[model samples]
Target: MAKQQVISPLPGTFYRKSAPDQPSYKEEGDQVAVGETIGLVEVMKSFHEIKSDFAGTVTKFLIDNEDAVMAGQALVEIDG
Candidate 1:
């Protein structure tokens, strides 16, 4: 298996769940498909969905929920 990373497309606050009460979009060890949403990045009150470009299992999350992130930062690691 090869490891891949899900990169953030924007600089903002990263959120694991849509809302505080909602479950995370993808958790560690979860299977992910291409174009699947894994998280959201809030920029200036605007929310953007972060999608995975690779199909694989979620291995790790590099950024914590509600953490600040920059464009091109690795959000999660995936094993395919």
Candidate 2:
């Protein structure tokens, strides 16, 4: 299995859920495809939908929810 780098498109805080009490968009081992909404990033009070760019299982999540992230930072690792 090859590891596909899933990078953040913009600088923001990465979140795993739509809300604090809600379930994460996904978890490890979940299968995802390109264009699928995987998470959300909040920047300047705006919420941006974070999507998968590859089809595969979620091998890992490189960034923690609510963590400040930079543009081009790896957020998720997909086995594509």
Best by lDDT: 1
Model 1 — which ten-residue stretch has the worst lDDT? 50-59
User: What is the C-alpha lDDT profile of model 2 across 13-60, one tens digit per residue?
Assistant: 999999999999999999999999888889999999999999999989
- TM-score to native of every candidate shown: 0.98, 0.95
| TM-score, cand. 1 vs. native | 0.98
For model 1, what is the alpha-carbon lDDT of residue 64? Answer: 100
Candidate 1 per-residue C-alpha lDDT over 1-44 given as tens digits, one digit per residue, 9 for 90 to 100: 99999999899999999999999999999999999999999999
User: Candidate 1 deviates by what RMSD?
Assistant: 0.5
The total number of steric clashes, by the backbone 3 Å criterion, in model 1 comes to 0
Tell me, what's the RMSD of every candidate? 0.5, 0.7
